[model samples]
Structures are given as C-alpha cells and as structure tokens.
Target: MSPLIDCLLIGLGATLIMDLWGLVRHPLLGMPLPSYYLVGRWLGHMPKGQFRHQAIAKASPVPGETLIGWLAHYLIGVSFAALLLLITGSKWLTSPSLTPALAVGLVTVLAPFLLMQPGMGAGIAASRLPNPGQARLHSLITHGVFGLGLYLSALGLRLFN
Candidate 1:
C-alpha cells in the first residue's frame, strides 16, 4: 500500500485503540472523550469571539458533529505518521524506536495547547476548565497515550513489512 494509505490506516487504528481503552477505563461519555470524531464540527461551529473561554463554549460541538471531528482528527494523526515515515522512511515504520514516536506524540501537544485550546476558549492547557489542574492532567494522559499509540503502531507496521 502507498505510504499515505498506510499512514491513514495506522492513524485511525491507533486512535480507535486509545479511544476504546479510554471509554472502558473512564466512561465520562461526552466530557472526557467529547466524541473526538467531531473535531471538525467543533472547529466549524466554533463561536466567533475574542475571549478564549467564550469561544470554546460557543464551539460546543454535539454528537451529531462528531463524525467530521473524528475524520479530521484521524487525518491529522495520519499526517503526523506520514511525516514520521518521511523522516525515517519505511524502515522506521517497520522497526521504529519508541524515542522518535514518543517524541512526535509528546510534541503534538503544541497544536492543542496553543491553537485548539485558545480557539476553543479553554485557555492554554485547559486553564479555562472548571478544574484546570485536572483538565491539564487529563490532556497529558491522553496525549501520552497518543505517543504510545505511535510507538505501538510503528511496531505493528514493522511486523507487516
């Protein structure tokens, strides 16, 4: 398969695994998972406001919009994986060290912390949440899972190759 195709599948797969695990472990339904699939819906319906807090709440995407968000989210993941593949090439995907995957995963935080958060009005690192500390911690954990997903997906790809 083409690298892009491979990356797309890998991204979706990783997301599913991590998300399912989250559902089973902590079933907060909307609050925690927020139907990640609706990332685009959330982005699309985002209320226009200068204030970060207001904007995020205004962009409150519903379950109906989740499909778009999920697609967008996975696409981003695939893009991330493809970048890694390009950097290291196929060899890396097949037998990548956790270092690179983990690095990429961890570094991925910038987008949410900076753009997404502020745009959504949650403030950086979720400073706008009811409990900023817990929200930040939760985000950290999820992103950490994403990093692990990268590493595990690489291992799986390696096996296939």
Candidate 2:
C-alpha cells in the first residue's frame, strides 16, 4: 500500500479500537456513551436550568463537525505513521517502536486542553472541572490508550509487511 494510505489506515484503526473500548467500558462505569446524534438529542432535552452551562455538550456536533473531528483524528494517526516511516522506513511500519509512537501520541493533549474543554466551557484543559486532577488524569489515560493502540497497530503492520 502507499505510504499515505498506510498512515490513514493506522490512524482509523487506532481510533476505532479506542472508541470501541470506550463503548464497552463506559457503560460498565455508568456513563452514557452516546453517538454524536444522541448527544444532540440529549442536549435538546436538558433541563432549562443547566441548558446554558451545557449548551456545547448538549448541542450535537453537526455532521460537518463530526466529520472534521474524525478526519482530524485520522490525520493525527497518519502523521504518527508517517513519522515512523521517516524514522524507520518500511521496517518502522512493520514493527513501529513504542517509544516514538508514545511520543507522537502525546499530541492528543491538544484536544482536551484546547479545543474540547474550551468548547465545553470547562476552561483550558479542563482546569475548571470540579475535580481537575481526576479529569486531567482521565484524559491522560485515554490518550495513553490511543498511543498504545498506535504502537500495537504499527507492530501488526510490520509483521504483515
């Protein structure tokens, strides 16, 4: 496969794996993990008192927004794969090293710290969350899983290659 295509696959596969895991685990923890459309519906149904505060969370990201977010997620994955290709060439994709993958995966910090948190009105990086420490920790773990997914997928591709 072409290098760009390989990168795209790597990213998409990683995201799906992580998201699937979320679906399985979130319910066990009593959290409602809904699709973007569900989120929109829930927001519409929110009590009037909390509506202002949760406007962003309630407002389902439009299809365009969802598409853009997914594309960004994929691009982020592709970028990591591309980096691996540059560093280790064909061998990297076949058995991409965890060190680089983890390092590159750190970029996920941007999502919560900047875009998502602010949009949700939680302040930068969720500094304003009720339990900032726990929230930040959760974000870290989630992103860490994504990073691991990238590393493992790269290893799989390496073996396949």
Highest-scoring model, lDDT: 1
> How well does model 1 score by local distance difference test?
0.68
Q: Runs in model 2 with CA error above 4 Å?
A: 34-54, 58-91
Q: In terms of TM-score, which candidate is strongest?
A: 1
Off by over 4 Å in 1: 27-31, 46-55, 59-64
lDDT of 2 by residue, 35-128 (tens): 4433333333343433333446556444455555555555665666576556667666755778776766666667658855665667787787
| TM-score versus the correct structure, for each prediction | 0.78, 0.69
Assess each prediction's global lDDT (C-alpha) against the native. 0.68, 0.63
RMSD to true structure for each model, in Å: 3.6, 6.1
Clash-forming residue pairs, model 2 = 43-58, 94-158
